[model samples]
Target: MDLSMDPAYSITKSECVELCAGIRGEPYSVSVLKEGYCTAQSDGTFRADGTISLITGPRAVLVDTGGPWDRELLLSKLKEKDLTPAGVSVVVGTHGHSDHIGNLNLFPGATLIVGCDVSEGDRYLPNQLAEGQPYLIDDHVSVIPTPGHTGRDVSVLVKGTSAGTVLVAGDLFECCADEDSWRDLSENPELQEVGRQKALMDADVIIPGHGRLFRVHRTPLN
Candidate 1:
C-alpha cells in the first residue's frame, strides 16, 4: 500500500484551485457559499450546487459549477477571489449532472473537458472527451481523465512540490470512505473496477466533489 510507489503517483508542476464549498482539511484554498440543488435523478440521488477553484500557473480551473440558484453566488465568489469566467483556462465537469454543469456557460473562453463517452454536442457546450487523456494546463499541472460515476465523468489531478499529487475525484469516490460502498463489480464492472483501483492507489491528497477532503490510510487488498 505504498502510495508513493503506485503507478498513479506520477507528478507534474501546475497551479491548483478548488472552487467548491470548502472541504474541511484539503490542501487548496476554497471559497464557500450555499448554492442550489441539482434535480433529482430517477435513482433518487441529489447533488448540491457547490464548487471548487483550482488555480495553476497563470490559469484558473473550476471543478464543478453550482446550480442555477448559485450561479450568481459562483460569479460573486469568483469576483471576490479576483477570478472571472473569462479568465478561466478550463472547466472540468466531473459528470453531466445539472449541479456540475450549471455555470458552464459562464466560461466562454475555457475549453470544456468531460469523460470519453460524453457527447461534444451535448448541453455542456464546447465539450471534449477526457478518455483518460492528459491535458497540460500549462507547464505546471494536468487534468487526467478517470471516468466512472457517469460514462463521461472525469477528475483533475494536480502536481506540485507543495501539493505533490492531488486527485480531484469528482464523483469517482464521492467521499473518502465510499471505496467500501461497492458490493461487486458485476454491475458496470469496468467502472466499478476503475473506481476501486483509484481508491486503492496512493495519492498525497484526495479532493472529493461533495464531502470533506481526507488522507487515505493504507489497507491491504487482494
Candidate 2:
C-alpha cells in the first residue's frame, strides 16, 4: 500500500521543539561535531551540508562525516575529543549522499556502515537492516534502517540517554521545521514519512541531518 496517498498519514509531522539539547548517557556521550545547514546561494545553486556526530563509549562511533570540505573541521573535532581517525571504531553513513559520507575515507580502519551495508575493508558483515531489523551496537546503541529520503537511509538510536532516547536521524528529518520541505527532497516521501513518524514516536530527542537537536513532544492521551 502507498501510504503517501493514505489519509492516516495526512498529519504525520510531529510536534517538535527546536533547541540546543544535549544527550548524554552512561558509556556513551553524544556530541554534534558539526550542525548541518542548507542555504540558497546567490546563484541557482545551493550550499548544503549534512550533520556530523560523535558517539563516544566503549566503541567510538562517528555518524555522518559531512562533506569532503569539512575534513579539517572533522579532524579538529576528533582531536578535541582526544580521538584521531584511528580512534573511531565505526563510521556510519546514514545514506549514500556525498554531503553525508564524503569524509568516510578518513576512517579506513573503522568498521564502515553505509546504509544497510556493514563492511570492514573488503569483507562485508551481514545484518538484517534490509529486512527492517536493527543492528545493535551494544546495550545502549543500535543502528536501525529508516529509509525515506533515500532508499537506504538509517538512523542511530541511543537509548538510556540523558534525554531519554536520542536518535541521530539523517535526512529522515530534513529539520524540525521541514514539514514543507522534506517531501520535495525525498526520493520516496511515503517511506520517509513512515520513518519520520516512527522516529518521533520512539525518540524523545532527535538530531536531524541539517539542523540542531530538537525535542519531540507527543500529545498525552486523554
Candidate 3:
C-alpha cells in the first residue's frame, strides 16, 4: 500500500514539546520519536510504524516499538531524549505484531502491559467505568482493548497536555488511511469494526501505529 496518499503521512513539525492541536481535554506532553508506518507483508519485510515514544509525565512509555529492522535507530531516539532503555518505566504493545513488539525485550526491567499478559498492578483509573479497573496505570493513562488488527490488540489512551486525548494505537489505522485500507490491513477485517468504533470514540488524537500523530475527527457512521 502506498501510504503517501494520506494527509497524515507528512513528518510532524514538533519534537518533544507542548503544542496545542485543538483537542478539548486534559494536558500531556509528547515527542513523536518516530513516524509510524503502514504494515504490509511480502518478501520477508515487515513494513510498519517506527517506535512511538510517549511522555505522559508520570510514565515514560512506548506503545509500539516499530520493527526490528530499525532497532538501533529506535534506540538512538531514546538516547536523544537522554533516556536509556532501562530508564523507560513501561512498554506496551498495541498488539503482538513484530513491528510493535520488536524492542520489548530491550526494556526487560520495565513492566510489560499488553493484551491478556498484562501484569497485575495497583493503579486506579478515574473514568466512565471506574469499578475494578484492571490495567496497571491510572485513569490518567487508560488501556482500551482494540482487537482485530491482531486478536490481542490494545490501544493506550491518555489525556494529553495540549493535544487533549492521545492514543498510541498499535495497528489501529495501519498508518491512518481511509476506512478501506483500515479494513484491508487487518488480520480479521470482519472483526475490526468493533475495535474501530471503540478507538474513534475514545481517542481525540491518535499516534497511529505507522503514521504521524493525527487529530481524531469524529463523524457519524453509516
Candidate 4:
C-alpha cells in the first residue's frame, strides 16, 4: 500500500533541539552518543559529522557508528553504559555513507544492516526492503527503507518508547526544520517527500540524521 497517500493525518515539523538528554522507554532506551553536524567552510568545502546512537533493549542495537574519528568516543560511550563492543548484537547504518558506517569494523560479531542489506560476517541475509517491506527486529523494532537520501537509505523505527514511536530517520530528514534545505541534499526529492510524509504520519518523535530529536505534530485530515 502507498502509505504516503493515507489521508487520515497531516504531518508537520516543529521543535528541533539537541538530544543531550536521552529518551527512555520500556524495552528500549535511546541514547545519543554523538549529535551530527554539518558546517560550510570559508573555502568551498563542507564538513559533515554523523550522529551515533545506542539503543538498549532486549537486544543491544547500535545505530550509525559515526566516522573513523569517533572510534574512541564510541568505545568510551559504550563503556559508560557498561557495554563492550561484543555486547552489541546488531549495528545499523541507515545508509552506507562513510560518516555513518565508519566504525563498523569494531563489531565483528554483530548482525550488520547497511541500507537494505542485512548480513552476518561474510553471509548476507535476504530481506525485502528494496521492494518496500519493513524488516522486523522484534515486535517493537523495525528497519524500514526510507530511501532518497541515498537510493537505499533505511531508518530504524522503535515503538513503545517513552516519547511514543520514535523514528531514527537517517537523512530521510537532514534536520527537523529541513523543509527549506532537504531538497538540496536529497537524491530523489520526490520519493523522499513521500517517505517523509509517511514518516511524519507515523512517528511521534524523530531522531534526525544530523541534528537532534524532534517531535512530529500531526493534524487529523477530516
Candidate 5:
C-alpha cells in the first residue's frame, strides 16, 4: 500500500515520549534485544541504533540483527527470552546497513526478507519486497517503505492488538536522544520528515532503532 496515495495513513507531527499510548493487552510482546554500537558519525558523534526487536508469536520474526560483534549479546538476549535462532522462521531487515544486517550469519534457516534481493542457488532462500508498497508478510505484519535514513530504508509495523499498532522502526527515530541526531542521520531530509509523520500518525507504540520502546497517546478532547 502506497501510504502517499492512502489518506488513511495521515501525517502527524508528533512529540515523541510525550503522548502515552499504554499497552492494553499483550497478545504478543516486543522485546528489545540490545546489540552492537553503531559506527561513529562524520561529526565525531558515536551512535548506534543497533537495537533489534523480537516479536513473539506462533511463528516469530527477528527484526534487524545487530552488527557481527553483537552476535553473542543477540543470542543471549534471545535465549533469555526463550527464542532460539532455530525457531526464528523469518529474518526481516529495516535497511541494509552494516550494523543492522551484520548478524545474518546466525540464522541460516530462516526466510530472508530485505531491501535488496539475494540468491545462492538452493542454499539460500530470499523474499524480495516491492518498493513503495506494503509487504504483508502475514495478516498481522506489514513492511512499509519509509525512505529517509537511507533511500531504500523501510520500517516494520506489527499489530499489537485489534486496535493497537507497534512500529519496529530501524534508524527512523533515534529517540529524544538528540534533535539534530535524527536530522543528521537522514539521507533525504524531506522524505525522512514525511515518513516520520506517517509513523507518528499510525503507530501506537514505537520501538525506535537506537532508543527504548515508547508509546504514542492522544489526550482525548471533550
Candidate 6:
C-alpha cells in the first residue's frame, strides 16, 4: 500500500507497541499524559496539547506540558505518580505554542530545550534557555528538531531502555489516528510530511501531542 497516499498516513490508531514489537526489537513502555483535543479561535489555532514523560536512565524527561485547561489536573496526576515537578531534570516543548508551553513555568530548574528557530525573544518564562539543533539531555535521551507543526516544533527521543526508542511528538502528529485532526498539523503538507517521515524513522513508540500512546514501525526512508 502507498501509505503516503492513504489518509491513514496522517493518523491511524493501532496497537503500535505490539506492531513494533513484532518487528524484532524491544518496544518502549509509554505513558500518555493527556489525551483529548482543543480548538483555536484564531488564525493560529493549534490543538491537541498534551504531555509525555519518559524515564531514561536515572533522569526523567518531560515532553511538552499541556495547556492551562489541564495544568492542575496534570499536576495532580504527576504528584499521584510520585513524579514531582522539581524532580524533572529536562523539560522540552515540541513548539512554543501557548498550549504546549502553558505549564512550563512549573519546572523552574529543568533545562529548557527548544529548537534553533525558537529565539530568546520568544515568551518563555524566566530562567529558561533556548537552544539549537539536537540536544542530548543524557547519554540515552535527546531532543531533535522536527519543525513542522510550527517553526519551533521539536520531538523528544529516549533510547537505552527495554521499551526501545520513544518519540514524544508534540503537535507533530496530534494523535496520528484522527482524520480530521490532520488539519491541526499545519497548512504546509510538505512540512507535515517531513515531520511524519522523521517520526516514522526515529521512534518505535509514537507519543502524540494529544491522545493515547501507540507504537510506530521505524522504516528507513533514507
**Model 3 over residues 1-222: C-alpha lDDT tens digits?**
222223433322222223322223344456667776555577866555554656646667666777787689878988987888888887787777676777777887777776645642444224322232335466577667677776767777777456667777767666555447677667787666765655565556676666656665544434
Best by TM-score: 4
Candidate order, lDDT descending: 4, 2, 5, 3, 6, 1
Q: What is the TM-score of each candidate against the true structure?
A: 0.67, 0.90, 0.73, 0.93, 0.77, 0.71
TM-score of 3: 0.73
- Per-prediction CA RMSD (Å): 7.2, 3.6, 7.5, 2.7, 5.1, 6.5
lDDT of 4 by residue, 1-222 (tens): 233355676566676454457878898988788888877899989899888888898999999999999999999999998999999999999999999999999999999999999999999999999999999999988999998988999999998888889898888888777765888888898999888888888898888888877888777778
Predicted candidate 6 versus true structure: per-residue lDDT over 171-202, tens digit per residue? 77776575545655585656767767656755
Residue 169's lDDT within candidate 3 is: 70
Q: lDDT of each structure?
A: 0.56, 0.85, 0.62, 0.87, 0.69, 0.61
Candidate 5 local distance difference test against the native? 0.69
Backbone N/Cα/C clashes per model: 20, 0, 10, 0, 2, 7
Can you give the lDDT of residue 44 in candidate 6? Answer: 80
Provide the lDDT at 208 for model 5.
72
List candidate 2 segments past 4 Å from native: 1-21
| TM-score preference between candidates 3 and 6, better one | 3
User: After aligning candidate 3 to the native by TM-score, how far in Å is the CA of 89 from where it should be?
Assistant: 0.8
Q: Tell me the tens digit of each residue's lDDT in model 1 across 49-150.
A: 544545434566677776666678788877876777787777777777776677778876677775543323354533244445666655545566665556
lDDT score, candidate 4: 0.87
Residue 76 accuracy (lDDT) in model 6: 83
